[model samples]
Target chain A: MTIAATKQFCTFFVGGHYFGVPVLDVQEAIRYQEMTSVPLSSSVVSGLINLRGQIVVAFDLRRRLELPPRSDGAKPMNVVVRHLDGVVSLLVDEIDDVVETDEVTFEPAPATLKGVAREVILGAYKLKNRLLLVLDIEKVLSIEAITSGDGDDNAS
Target chain B: MTLVGELVLARNQVLQFSATQSDPALLSATQQLNLLTSELQESVMKTRMQPIGKLWSKFPRVVRDLAGICGKRVRVQMEGEDTELDKTIIEAIGDPLTHIIRNAIDHGIEEPAIRTRRGKPEEGKLSLKAFHEGGQVNIEISDDGAGINVEKVRAKVLKQGLISPEQLTRMSERELIQLIFLPGFSTAEQVTSVSGRGVGMDVVKTNIEKIGGSLDIHSELGKGSTIKIKIPLTLAIIPALVVTSDSCRYAIPQVSLLELVRLDSEIAFKSVENIHGAPVYRLRGKLLPLVYLSSVLNTGSAQLNQDVASIDIVVLQADKLQFGLVVESIKDTAEIVVKPLGHHLKSASVFAGSTIMGDGKVALILDVVGLAEHAGLASKVEAIAASNLAGIQNDSTEGEKLLLVGVGDNSIAIHLSTVARLEEFPASAIESAGGRPVVQYRHGILPLVDLADFTGGYSAFSQNESPFQVVVCSGPHGIMGLIVDRIIDVVQENIQIQLIGERHGFIGSSIIHNKMTDLLDVHAVISSIDPSFFDEMKEALIGGVR
Candidate 1:
């Protein structure tokens, strides 16, 4: 049997679903900061945030996933990550701990997933209590996909 | 460098925090930190600069090869090779400079036989010079060869049907030479491999302008041509004016800023007028088109609020068009470090980039040209102004052209040949010298003549805040300014003077442009202002003191 390699992921929650991205790709997680809204941008672009003097465009994960809107008065956390061009922040409901899992527990993404989840979910990792959906950050942050959607929802 | 920018921002934040603290120790430390951070930022910026010689090193070979192909003899000479520019600008200018050099050799320089026949040296000289001027870099490429032929350009323009014969006759020689920069315009007898594929000069102009540089050409009939380019030193940092609209702050680059005007509610209501639906303000004697920032950005319909206590206008120049941008409030000016936006937001034409404010918030920087395009004002206003002038010019062409001015309720015309220039001066700039209103102009004193007061019309001269619209005229004594209420239109039509009763400051009355216009005797008006003015000037001239 081949030696089992372990991979670590920084996890977060959005619309009651567990999601994780490779730990190396994650920059940092911070509390909700004030955002300066862009007027005519796409719907998924929540606004721009100042992360210690660096301007980072924040994308709302709930809207990107086509899930139900978060309830009123609930502040979203910022999950900053590195991209090919620059740094971007993903707004999620809550932050979770970094989890380590063996490669043996990894499995291909199931065919049952629908909507945008099927496009951005790479695969899954079977944990002791539940399944952790692995997010493809490149596909999730695709410039073409973000700009080509029907921009109707107002994030402001 | 980005880390240095972040440090600068952090230091700014610290300075702001220290403003609230009264402790001497912390305040002194913050001041020291601010000084050190600024020095460090300057040092880092210097490291990014490289000598422009690095980019020009390969041009001699290019010139040699191009000269050989065209059967011309050209020698390359470069000056100020050590002139330093930002590394990015050095890289960006390489191709455009090469293209200009190629054109100088291929089109500007004459062949060896032609140069010998014209009594010029067989070897044509191509010189590249660079220097620093007015806080910017200037590069000039000149060649001593056959210059642009204005007659040939005019014929080519007509052959291409670019303009009508009447319009062509109206164009000056310099304007005709500028037609070479038009797209798909070439005066070459035949297309050659080295240049003249009908795509050279226009692309060169566009590429240079993209980097905030301007290109101008000067040529004589056979002396040669020189192309001068002026560009800013660096693009990483710029001074910008900050303003708020719908509570969102935006930064406008200071390069495009002309002046700021603040109008109180009372004056704003009377001064700002609407023509067809576009709002315009009478600045001096000219009509300035006004653009509302709120409506352009779609932030909110804040422009419809007629109860605003005051109006703040930021005059901006975008390309050849100048318009006033109305914002909600004016904030302080700051030196901002530019950062590019993410790729997803690149399609938004209005925003140039994003910058971090002193308060650690992100603010969007506006691209003036893109904003003008998005608002659909650049072409529309130009078309309207052009059509208005064209309609008047097409009406008549028989009599002398006259400048029409409005004095209170009367329209008066002055011979265009006698008018020196039109100028506008603020009311505050008018000072009293020897009990006469005079202003310092061109290193001399220009006396003011109030036409309204002279003609015994309704005198609005008491308002010290409104600017004076003056028509400058050269009298036998000196230059004098005739202050009028506004300037109407210029029309050329046969004069049929209807001699009315002798009126002060009026020679006779005539019907022009369907209005009763009085022909003003300029000499008589000047003499009436100060009877001794002409005598003093004549004495000075005779004494050889002038």
Candidate 2:
């Protein structure tokens, strides 16, 4: 039987940091539309948008990464991906096109990632310039983890 | 009132002035009251209860959640945004109302692209309107989306095993929606934050019902849906009637009861009959099954046979069960404040809750439908109604004997089943339909074959219980009383063959009784006499003299 090979995803940067989400999960990249707030959900779970007939929930990856909160004024773009039994569009600073890497070059995690942001990072991807943090877009945007007891404010 | 008010306000004023006028050190340490009425008013205004619409600002949220699931665009429009409710009640109605809005978006509202395809506006309109009416507030949430697919509900109900296929066939479309409230009934393949957890409608109903409220739903395919809620303005007081049954006091809501009728033993013995040991009354020509309160409570029958031997029949209408509850007497209707029953008393579903009467007596509020449900007699009521309708459909075919018998000077009517056999009495087999005086000659509607109505100029006299009347001993399901003049031979016929509409006794038989008579609509007479009397009930007109 003829074997089909999976495509290698490109590593990219936003604000001078490396990150990568699976190209397979990502449907397309688009500039932001008006996002409506989902009041009863977690802070990281931002809101939803009526995107071309499909209603997509948009989660803020910056908040999930525990970086400084974005000001309400930031005009960001969204990386739309199918997740959580439904499609979600991630509100991010930027997106990059595919760049090839050998699947054999994958590495394991060094030690404990046993903190709040551990599940967010899949095994790190090392690139020539620097390390490209492999982002587990599914885990980072999970409603359960985002709204757990460890949070400052209970989501529900 | 002024002195007490002055003391508190003045004390606060002193504290406030002392705090503002003194040195900073003393101000930090302690201060006397200095209450400007404006300051107090300012604080009150800060807490000044605004309309409950302050909470309604959350619907866009629900629309978003639902839109995410249904992949639709729903714009929520709210009116009566200034409607006010108690803070506590608002807190309770908020989550439930959100769920309703979400369901409306996810289920009622069709997909946005689908909308464009249907040649309709792409943006769906959802309105949440609340207005005060009567002593309660009515909240309505409607959506200009696809209404509930009644077919989908029917299929889902059967698929979810909520009801059998046979049941689905007979259920009205409205009944199909009711399946949504059957605890854990649902059809969604995947659970979502927006509806389909299975407890949505039931939770809404229970919460609303708890607050002395009710909900009504209206929907049509392709248009939209509306869920209207009726909730009391306040939980402080409600109209309730105090009644006694089996020596225990119950608060029956005046709203649900039809009327209270007094049945004296004198009239009771005449109208009430025992059918298969169950006492039923011929109320308005139909047999109404009598529910004695004492028996339902397992406390034995109450003594209704007092001075006048009176029994109070409290007529009730629950859903569809039109029943008469036999109680002692209705004391009075009063506005009573209800208190929740503690944990131990919660298991008693019969009592929705407990309330203190004006006389300080603790009375349990009766949940009439709950009692009928507990007894598993809800469908029995359906059987009664079906039989009544069936009675009308097969009128002349009612296969029971509307017997005509000779009284002193006239003919009287009786049920044939009550009469064993008639023989030539030689004028001595005379009996009464009761103590009524009529013609004495033995022939009656039976003698109409012999043309017997002309011998009516005879003298009349009374003969106790044994008069010349058709002996009607009240058959099990048909014909109870014997309105007889004298005994006449029994001849059976397929009752469907009604005697001609004119004054005739038996079919094709010219036997004319003293009174004008229509052929007994046998099946009707049978079922009307007692619904339990038929052999499949509909088999009534079929059972004539073979």
Candidate 3:
């Protein structure tokens, strides 16, 4: 049997940790812009940003991951990805270079992954210098679980 | 043609014209093209409009079936059916119209015997009239039945524990009649299969409001009831006022945006005051509740410079209450295409939806209704201010009666007309329900809102064993009690109300006799308890009164 060469992942930084989502899921990355905040929305929803006439819901990766806020208080980059019928912007600390690695190198999420990051992290790919936590975009952006305050029992 | 298609064509033409404006001949051609495009756009919009007769065509059959089912002699009179409206409105109005007609036949038109005894013809007259009024299609469904019995509605509401007897006493005849529209409130004693199976006027109201329309119910005892549904010509395109706050643009639908006011910093400092953390602006002669757009959305501060020369405020009217939205600045007014928010963000009530601006940036449309509710500014403060202003103008010389009530250390006087009654409820009876203190009064539930709690005053009775002195005040938010230490005497005084320090429930202070008396803002107190408390009250008032 022939083995696949490699899979590409778009990596980004959040709270000093490197996270990567499948490259196929990422549409583009743009500089952070002003966003209109939605009142009474889930805490993780950073706000709404206007992307070339398309209103995109921007989710704060740090808030979703339950990580500490950026100490420098700098506006983050927006990683636009297709989410359901529309697009959602994932706010990250910074954009890192896309890394390609063999699929076999990926491992299931470690039991040590703490807090919200553990809940959303799909798996991790070991790199030469560090570990790139693979994030499930769908799981990370599922606001229903947080808003409805329901346990992870019957999430579709 | 769809307005979206026409908009695309117009945008393209404008873009093409701007791109080649250097060519004079091309400029003239573009001008002519723009004119033709607008004219064509108007013609296309006209095609989407259909005569109201199409909507009324089925009403005859509806009325006939309704009469047969109710076993009543009825005649359907249609007028001004030629008045036209958008086809979508005509289609959406069918069900609500049927519900109203069924209501008219089953409850509006009295039985033949009762009609004859009331000295009216045995053949009841039910009129389905349509007309164009104020740029809207007004459809009136009136019937010559024994009009809605406000007393029965009051009794039903009381029995259902929707409101207190104190509230019922304060309610006007029209307001009492409107209680019929409350969900699960059917004045009909019998569970009629026809019109009153508990699935009531709320459904009809929701449907009407969903179409960007309003419902009005007017009924006179022993005469008849007229239910009017007013809908706009179209909903595809709406004029919107674009605004910026926290560096982000938002669109306020022109329908809800009443006006804009720009106040100089000096004037703003003089007029704007925070009453118990909620900002209010004194506009003209009345207090206008103000909501900071930034605070509501948890975004950056509107960053309003206190030392700046001027500040811009958008006067927004949501339902009945009018409040000022403090924004960074006001942009241009334009016709916008409203797009629904994706399913994920549907729970965000602050946004009605998103609209693309002329600059091709997505501007989240500010749902004035939602914003008002979210900011807890949905109060009857405007009405209170209006009445107070009228009193100041007309009754300055005349002594205005006031109800004196004793709170912990202070004596407060509220307008006597606004006070429903003074009652005492057992402290133990004050149960916590829906996160609010409620008491059972006269077989009805009365939400007890402690003005003293909000105003930093004291409550004398902390033990549930003691009888709680409740000063029941009636505002637009039904009836709420100002838990006081005791009820003082009713005084007729003409003392001028002097401006005191900012307080949530107190309007100001006035010297009465030897002591200083705090003048209470009755509306503010009730609204502070629950913002949405008055939203339904306004709809009910409008639906039944005018």
**Which candidate number maximizes lDDT?**
1
Residue-by-residue lDDT tens digits, candidate 1, A102-149: 898999898998878999999999999988999999999898888875
Interface RMSD of each: 1.9, 23.7, 7.5
Per-candidate TM-scores read: 0.69, 0.45, 0.61
Query: Which is the better candidate, 1 or 2, if ranked by lDDT?
Result: 1
Residue-level lDDT of model 1, residues B357-473, one tens digit each, is 888888998878778877878545755466557652433436777899988888889888779999888889898765678776787778888888756788576575888788999
Tens digit per residue, CA lDDT, model 2, A5-120: 33455444444557777788888888867654432235665655556434466767776776675566777678887774567777777667675554545565556766644777
Better candidate number, 1 or 3, judged by DockQ = 1
Residues B1-546 of candidate 2 have per-residue lDDT tens digits of 222323333443345455457577656443422334435533443343358688898768867766866778778888999987755567778877887887787677877788888777998989989898765688999998888788888887777787789988977777677677677776566787666888888888788877766677888889888998877655544577778764557777765677778877788766666544556676544567777766665555333454647778888755456677887677777655555543223344656665544333345677776666655455555555566576433232344545565544444344454455443322354333222222234233121011233223242323343333333333455333333345443333333333444432323222333344333322333334335433433243244323
The parts of candidate 3 lying over 4 Å away from their true place are A1-34, A50-53, A70-156, B1-37, B118-120, B144-192, B195-200, B219-224, B257-306, B311-317, B320-328, B348-350, B371-391, B394-546
Q: Score each candidate by Cα lDDT.
A: 0.84, 0.60, 0.77
Better of 1 and 2 by TM-score: 1
- Candidate 1, CAPRI quality class derived from DockQ: medium
lDDT of 3 by residue, A5-64 (tens): 688999999999999998889999999887766555676776677776567888888877
